[model samples]
Target chain A: MEAILKVEDINVYYGSIHAIKGVSFEVNEGEIVTLIGANGAGKSTTLNTISGLLHSKTGSVTFMGENLGKIPCHKIVSKGLALVPEGRRVFLQMTVQENLEMGAFTQGGKTLDDDLERVYEQFPRLKERMKQVAGTLSGGEQQMLAMGRALMSHPKLLMLDEPSMGLAPILVEQIFDIIQELHKAGTTILLVEQNAQAALSVADRGYVLETGKVVTTGTGHELLESPAIKKAYLGG
Target chain B: MEFLSYLISGVSLGSVYAIIALGYTMVYGIAKMLNFAHGDIIMVGGYISFCAMSYLGLPGWLATLLAMAVCTVLGIVIEGLAYKPLRSAPSLAVLITAIGVSYFLQNSALLIWKAAPKVYQPVVSGSLTLFGGQLSVPYASVLTMAACLVIMAALTLFISKSKMGKAMRACSEDKGAAQLMGINVNATISTTFAIGSALAAVAGVLLCTSYPTLQPTTGSMPGIKAFTAAVFGGIGSIPGAFLGGLLLGVIEAMAKAYISTNLANSIVFAVLIVVLLVKPAGLLGKYVPEKV
Candidate 1:
């Protein structure tokens, strides 16, 4: 499979503290690749670096054969990589529909109607609350809105940072199902999650991260069955 | 009947304050800075219009347009040179920088125009006789109030319907998420300054026309009053600025008539203190609880 995204030995620092230490990963076309780790294991940091929100101190991030080092964070979305940021940072003052419209900022007005229809079809709850302010939405609904907003850009590779974070078990399962559905629709996904068991269950491949380094890499089934992963992450 | 005249004059003054307050509220909303230099921009606008009409013999409308254009460019330049570099700096640092810019503009105007006050020719002269001349409204006052209403309506529509306006709202709410969504936060901020400065120019023109005094310090008092007005209405709300400006003007006018003129300013400020103590978020501002 063709690699849609390639991260090579990227190092990142926040002030004096090193956050990501020479981490490397790749997501191929038509794959649901997950980076599973505990909190502060550099999952969000790596995704942010890829999205150009944070710059790497060393190494490179290449998306669709383009080096993303010099690209501004705002311009990164136009290149077809979208990050549904952690905490579901939807514009709180904006209406649900306005928030979704902001997601399609890089696109022309031509595709907006059709894109809105598709997003609404995916999350009917968002459509129901389209006129309501986003801050008023429930957590699960906010997550769906964040995801729906990202999809508005027609992203080639969607990177989700802890979409299931803070969600109830049922809502978490629903979000994972949506991830799988999007993957089947032919979009590559790079997911970061603390929910290792659910991540492994839905991921085609998984990379286990510990203390800013990838400790192990395997297929979903392999990671699920591994005694080390089960003890460390899956709660054996 | 006498009280009605005072109220009318107060509304006229309030309209000018409202225009200036719009400048403050908008820049504060998007850039998250008080932009203390905003009042100085009004001074610059007055000087520009004064020069255009007196030296170049331009028509009143043309001079006002020229002032707006110059102020717009100046706003962008000030934001780029003074505020843009301090984007990631602390709010205190930005506020200090704004104050520095304000002093710089005042000194520059002093050197260019000198301290002598210039008498501004009213852009619109004559008065409307109402209730058999017992109530007379100056054309300048009518024009100022009309301009304020039109500007408020236009600005409201622009912010609600325009793509750039939406981007501005997004940036104001969350800059990081806005950047993630491909909205250029910096450009939105610069655009905000441009619009604010242009409005400052209009306010300057209207103010000078009504009051008939033009000096480097002309913008300072009104600027401070309008800032007070913005806070009274809610610093980040557009409609709040309008309501606050009108109310402040009327209160000031009423105090001047009923109370001592020397105490009018004091009463206006006292009202602000009371409002803040009562509401804490201004009249219309939302109280966002800090996330622990």
Candidate 2:
């Protein structure tokens, strides 16, 4: 399997504070690879760096055989890389349809209707509330809207930062189910989550990050059953 | 009859304020900064139009178009040079920078054109006498009001329907999310400035035509009044700016006629204070509660 994304020894800093210290990871063409860690463990930072929101001081992020270092953050979405940012930052004031339209900002009108149909088919709740203001939607609905919005770009690789965060347990399961559904549909996903159990349950492979470094890498089952991961993340 | 005349003149003045206030509200909406230099842009537009007409012997319509084009370029240049670098800076810092730019433009105009006020030729002359000459409306006032209405409608459609307009709304809501969605936020902001400054040119021309005075300081007082009008109606709302401007104009006119000319400005500001105390978000602005 070809690696769709390759992150090599990237270091990032926020002013003088080094936030990401030499982190590296990869996701294959058709796989759900998750980076699971505690709060402030640099999981979101890694995803942000790949999406071109933050620049790394060292190393490279190669996506589809092209280096993403020079591309601006906005242009990165057109390059088939989309990030569903933390907290499901949907445009609160805009209508649901407008929010989805904004998602396809790079694609113009071609394939827009078909894409909207596809997204609506995937998320029927959004269709029912297509004209509703996004802020009025419940937390779970907003998550789906954010995910659906990213799919509008027809991204080759979808990077979701904490899609399950702040969601109810049942909604978390639903979100993970959608993740698995999209994975089976042949979309490559790079997920960052603090919910270790749920993440590992759906991920084909997982990396355990601690203090900006990958401490363990294995099949999802292996990480799920590992004693250290079980104790530290799985709440053994 | 006298009251009706004052009301008509007031509406005409309000129309000019409304046009200028649109520029303020738009830049404030997207850039989340008060481009205090906006009023000075109006002055620059006035000077540009004045030069094109007097020095170049251009027709009124051609001169207005030329002013709009020049101001559009000037707006983009100003954004690139002055405001773009301060994108991530604190809002207070941006506001101060805007003030600095305002003074710079004013001083530059002073040096270029001198302080002597030049009489501006009316783009439309004569008056329409109504109700057997008891009520008379200047043709310039009619043109100004009509121009303001057309601009307001066109701008409303442009903002609500255009792709760039949607991007501007997105950027105003969340810059990071907008960037992630592949919307070039910088370009959207530049477009906002361009539109706003172009409108400033139209407003400048209308203002000079109605009042017939052109000077470096011409845009300052009206600019300040328009800014107040924006805040009075709701700083970020297009329609709010329109309403606020017209109301402020009527109030000033009524005050000058019924009360005292010296007290007209005072009454206008006092009304704003009262309105703000009643609705802190302005008449049309949404009251977004702070997330604790």
Candidate 3:
């Protein structure tokens, strides 16, 4: 499989604090890759750097062989990479459908009927509440809306951070189910999650991150069986 | 009969304020900043109208159109140079910069146009009889009301039906996410300022004709009043601002006629305070739930 996104020795800093230190990873086309980490472990920073929200001090980020350095977030999005940022940051004042419509803002006036129908098919709950304001939705619903909004962009690469955060156990299952559905639909996913066991269940490959660096990388089944992963992340 | 004439005057006056309030509300709704220079934009519009009419010898209608055009361009320039640089700065910094811009523009006008007030000639400065009551509405006043109504209608349509309007609203709700959706955040902000400043120009032109006198600092009181109107109506709601302005104008007029004229401002502000205390979000402010 060809690499759709390649991050090589990327260094990102926030003022004096270095967040991502020479992080290197490759997300191949049509694969689900999970990055698991503890808090302040530089998971979000790596995603931010790739999405053009934060500039890297060193190293190169290539999406489909095009360099992503110094590109604005909007322009980066136009190239078919969408980030469903942490905390389900749906536009609260807009309706659920409007939030989805906004996902297509980069598409200009292109046909969105298929994208809209696909999103509705993925999250039926969102379709029922399409007219409701996003801020009024439950935490899990908002998460679904956030994912639904990103999918509306018809992105080639969907990078999600903590989509199950604060979600009910049932809703978390639903979110993960949607992630699997997205992968099956041929969208490449780069997922970041603290729920290592659940993420590893669906992820084809897994990278365990500790303190701003990749500590281990292997096949999902291998990491799931590893004693270190079991002791630190998956409780016996 | 006197009361009826006052009603007409109040409605016309309120409409102008409402137009100005729309600019404030639109920008505040999206940027969550007051754009303090909004009032000065109105002053700039008036000066532009004066120059077009008196200096360039353009007719009244042509001058008004020219004023709107010039002020629109000026608005885009201000956003590009002033507000754009401070986009990521703290809200206070932006607020102070806006105030500074307002003062700078006003002082520049004073220096160039002189401190003396200029009155744009009234296109209709006559009396009309309606329902056995004689009322006088300056042609400028009628024109102002007509212009405001048309603009308000157009803006309402744009916001409700246009793609750019939806983008603006979405950006207002969540700028970061809007950018992720491929919306040009900078361009949206600039467009918001441009539309707002253009509305201010219309108000400026109308006001000069109605009052027949203008000064460099003419926009301050109106600016404050329109800001108050924006707050009184929900800050983010276009229709709310218009309603609030009309309500404020009528209340002020009634207080002046029936109550004490000196107490009009106090009464209006007191009403605003009472409304805010009851509902901090204003009349049309919707409740948004925070993350649990």
- TM-score top scorer: 1
Evaluate candidate 3 by giving its C-alpha RMSD to the native, one decimal. Answer: 1.8
Kindly list the per-residue Cα lDDT of model 3 for residues B1-292, writing each as its tens digit.
7897777777777887899999999999888899888988888888888888888888877887888888889888988988888988999999998999899999999998899888766534665556655666555557767887898899999986688998898888778778888888889988998899889998888877777778999888888888988899889899888988888887887888889999988998999999999988888876566555
Task: Score residue A77 of candidate 3 by CA lDDT.
Answer: 86
TM-score of chain B of each: 0.99, 0.98, 0.95
Worst 10 residues of 1 chain A by lDDT: A206-215
lDDT order of candidates, best first? 1, 2, 3
TM-score of each: 0.99, 0.99, 0.95
Single out the weakest 10-residue window by summed lDDT for candidate 1 chain B: B283-292
For every model in order, what is the number of clashing pairs? 0, 0, 1
Off by over 4 Å in 1: none
The numbered model that scores best in DockQ is 1
Evaluated on CA atoms against the true complex, candidate 2 attains a DockQ of 0.92
- lDDT, candidate 2, A148-174, per-residue tens: 999999998999999998999999999
lDDT by residue for model 3 over A150-197, one digit each (tens)? 887778999999988988888889889989988998999999999998
Consecutive 10-residue window with the lowest summed lDDT within model 2 chain B:
B283-292
When sorted by TM-score, best at the front, the candidate numbers are: 1, 2, 3
Q: For candidate 1, lDDT tens digit of each residue in A57-143?
A: 889999989999889999999999999999889988899999999999999889999999999999999999999999899999999
- Model 3 global lDDT (CA atoms, 0 to 1): 0.87
lDDT at residue A46 of model 2 (Cα atoms):
94
Q: Write the per-residue lDDT of candidate 2 for residues B1-292, one digit (tens) a residue.
A: 8888999999999999999999999999999999888898888989998999998999999999999999999999999999999988999999999999999999999999999999898777899998988788999999999999999999999888888888888999899999999999999999999999999999999998888899888888998999999999999999999999999899999999999999899999999999999999999998887543
Ranking by DockQ: 1, 2, 3
